[model samples]
Target: MFQGMPLAGAQAGGGIVSLIVPLVLMVAIFYFLMIRPQNKKQKQRNAMLNQLKKGDKIVTIGGLHGTIAEITDDVVVLRVNDVTKLTFDRNAISSAVSRETAVE
Candidate 1:
């Protein structure tokens, strides 16, 4: 005869705590490992974009290198060569090249 039944209340509390603890740990790990670094990089990139000016040599995300010929609100004109100029969005620029590097 199977007449021994465990009370529901005792098991429910442990079950809830076990589920909640892992969910909280997962969120904390994701924030530190993934979200935090991505946000920091975005802030740095935004600062670089805002400081762009004429004669700053830069490389685009597409690997083109050029000097900033002009800057508008959201666009950039790049002089890749003496007669070759290209236009791109400000966000397309990756990083600025130093004057020494630009000369070489």
Candidate 2:
């Protein structure tokens, strides 16, 4: 038996709580700093996907630029050139061209 030792139950419970508080704080920090922004971006991306329409000029994730010729539930037909049409997933479109691009 060790003399001058702290009570077993109290010491063990306090030590566990001390360890858990930092872990909980870390999870909260990660949620705010990392997870929250990622979810926001995903929501924006989903909104963009839902708003796809014909005649919308868009840039794909692959950097291809084209105007939407047709839109399906999950596929987009892009008219890249007079004879160069391409099909891509709705998610593959990164963003629509702004009004600045339409003027030119």
Top lDDT model: 1
Model 1: per-residue Cα lDDT over 25-93, one tens digit each: 999999999999999999999999999999899999999999999999899999999999999999999
Q: What does the lDDT read for residue 44 in candidate 1?
A: 96
| TM-score of each prediction | 0.89, 0.87
* Per-candidate total of colliding backbone pairs: 0, 0
lDDT of 2 by residue, 1-103 (tens): 8767878786897899999999999999999999999999999989888987898999999999999999999899999988999999888998999757663
Point out where model 1 deviates above 4 Å.
Answer: 1-8
After TM-score superposition, what is the CA distance of residue 5 in candidate 1 from its true location, in Å? 5.3
Q: Give all candidate RMSDs, comma-separated.
A: 1.7, 1.9
The candidate that achieves the highest TM-score relative to the unseen native structure: 1
